[model samples]
Target: MRILQTDPDDARFAAWCGVWAASQRADRPDELPRPAREHVALGRRLVEPGGSMAGTHRAAVAGDAVVGALRLLLPVRDNTAVAYVDLAVHPDARRRGVGSALLEEAGRIAAAAGRTAMVAEVDEPVPDPPGRAFARHHGWTCDLQESRRDLALPVDEDRLSALETEARAAGEDYEVLTWRDRTPDALAEDRALLGRRMSTDAPSGDVPVEEEHWDVARIREDEAAHLARGRTVLTGGAVRDGRLVAYSELHVPLEEPERAHQGATLVLREHRGHRLGARVKVAVLRELAATLPQVRRISTYNAESNRPMVAVNEALGFRRSGGLSTWSRRI
Candidate 1:
């Protein structure tokens, strides 16, 4: 079987990969975005900056038909740090050698760039037997556990109000804000400060939080990109004395047109005990309900060991969906 690599923007390769992905997902019990096209679009945007040490892409055409594929995201922080990998195999190609070939290629690409590690993630509610087996066979070790949670739709107003009151009484402050096309200049600055404290408070494995900071220009560009796809980003922050301490972002997946996903929530180190993390999250949910009335469900995830976050999500009426274990191997 011959292997071919293509830029995510290559139309012919993308169409072939999309066709294969559609056929495979036809039998699944749960819903997921069609793989190949979604990944291709992701890859294109990630690789646009010039002199980016990392590579961005999608791959297909192992041997005969386009049976399986993978997307590789190079790191933005450490030049030598191997980046994220996203893979999918056509249903009919399961148990075949296609996946193995693709993974071997991934290792080669990493090794060529002197990278020692690669990271991957999968959503809950998806069966991952083949993926689990591939990692094991390749000597990749499972290192971290992430838990996914889903918030009920048409949020219970009385229950949400009670939670907010309890959090406030505990010395925390909460506010939810929504914007049209751009995040306010002041909020963007707060995001930078909040980003600096994430590693200290959030669950992180051997991977270091790359010190790459986001400025207004960067955040603005990202917002425009999201809006271009018909999605909306709403920010919820916890503040004291006009200073932003903790924040969370909720994203509506407009392309899919049905579900909304909680992006990322963080609380600074000095503000941990007051339940600001949970308060900000629930606040985001309330904002989404008010703004986008058509959303069906909202989902978010945290490391399985993050009992604090888990407890807060549960308090806000989000149920445990399932867990995903992140696996990695050195090239």
Candidate 2:
């Protein structure tokens, strides 16, 4: 098999992107199938500095046809010693050496870039999915477990009202604020601080990563990238003493009107236990309901170990659909 660099705008890249969606549909029959346009947007190259890029792509071709794909996410600002991998072999090409060949090339690329480890997320459904087994058989350690939870939208108003009412009493000292797309100039710095904390504060089992470096400039760059990628971001933040203490973000792709994603919800450690997480998420849900009523489902992934946040999501009516195991191996 010949592995070649594929341009995002080219047909091969489109075919390569299809491999991921196709694999998911075949393996996770219970999950909703992603629209092809959404998959293409996901695979679009966002080559800004640091961890902003969707990832670099390599298409594995054999018999003059593409049968596998590889995405290597390199972190420049931090975690310079590792490469994040997203690989998929066409269902028809499985067991034909396509997966192995693509992974071999991935290691070479990571090593050439001076990275010492490769990390990947594999499906780990009940009874041990083939993908997770393959990772273990190839010497990758399952480092973390994240379950995908989905909430069917149009949240019951009475339930949301009660959640908000309870949260208000708990977070009475804080104020909730909402915005769309970009961070307000006054809260830009606050947003950056939370964004940086997200890297370290979130539960990251054995995954090797570091606190992400963030600043107002980087925040603007990220917002710009989102606009360029056709993604609409809705954010809700909690303010205490005129500074943000907690925040939640909702990401909706313009093309996929029916699908939405819950990006991150964080409360400063010192600010925890006040239901700020729930309060901010409730604010976001309200904004989503009012402005983007077309969104029918919101998907989120959380480490199984994060009980507090999981409790909040459960209270908000999210149910588990599937899970992913983070697999890592030293090169």
Candidate 3:
């Protein structure tokens, strides 16, 4: 098998890569299947510098056909020493040395770049047949566990009203804002204010990421496009003091009916301790219920250690859905 450093600019092959991912998704149980257009858009974003682009993606090709591929994404800057391995092996061609070849190439790329490690997220009940053996054979170690939760919507109106009332009593200083055609100027400033919190607060395991490596412009484009595609709703609540203290997103899957996923709900450091976060979250859920009542479930995941956020989610009625394992190994 020969490995090729594929060009991100090759439109025809890029389109093929998008199709390959969607086809692979067909076998995964939890994720909703994606349309070709959405996959293309996602692929474009992942390779774009300000977007989710990591190092390089290589394809394992035999003769004229592309059989397997590997995707490496740079999720954190300080962890520039590391890369997230988003793996894909065409269903028809698994076990033919495709996966092994791809992983070997990945290690070479990481080492050359001066990165110290590489990681991937795998589902649990691990020692179960396929993936467990594959990971072990590759020298990948499973280290962390994450819990997933799902919230049924149309949040009891009484519950929402009561929470809103309690929140207002705590401090009637922040208002939740969405990004419309004309997003408030304050929104941009709020992102800046909350930027530090994002770089430091999220559950990145042992990776130090500085704010500079984060592509703010890419974030804006992706968020805007995601909104346009009707995939996500982003809400930021800014304090009257001009600070964006808390933010959350309710992701509405485009292809699936009545299913939405939640992204990171961040509350700035200084803004903690007050019941503001709990209020902000419930308020967003309530608004989602009122506006997108068709949504059946909303889901989120938290590091098993994030007690504060988990407590808030539990209060908002999100229940455990599943768990994912974050495995890391030094090169």
Top candidate when judged by TM-score against the true structure: 2
* Candidate scoring better on TM-score of 2 and 3: 2
Model 2 stretches with alpha carbons more than 4 Å out: 29-55, 124-127
Cα error, residue 18 of model 2, in Å, equals 2.5
lDDT of 3 by residue, 1-331 (tens): 6777664566445644753665446555556555455544555566565544545667777776677767776653445677777566767678888888888878787787777888877654223535556778888776656787888876777777777687677766666555422235646556655654676687766433345333355456646667545475645354656666787666675566487777657777777666777766776676676677788888788887888888878877889866676777788
- Give the Cα error of residue 225 in candidate 1, in Å: 3.7
Candidate 1 local lDDT, 125-177, one digit each (tens): 55665567677787877767677788768878898889988887776344544
- Model 2, span 212-277: residue lDDT tens: 888998888778766766789999999999999899999988877688989989999989999999
lDDT of 2 at 259: 81
Off by over 4 Å in 1: 16-20, 23-28, 34-37, 50-54, 62-64, 124-128, 172-176, 206-212, 228-230
Checking candidate 3 for backbone clashes, the offending pairs are: 78-208
* Each prediction's TM-score versus the true structure: 0.87, 0.93, 0.80
Judge candidate 1 against the unseen true structure and give its global Cα lDDT, from 0 to 1. Answer: 0.68
| Candidate maximizing lDDT | 2
Candidate lDDT (C-alpha), each: 0.68, 0.85, 0.66
* Candidate 2 global TM-score: 0.93
lDDT of 3: 0.66
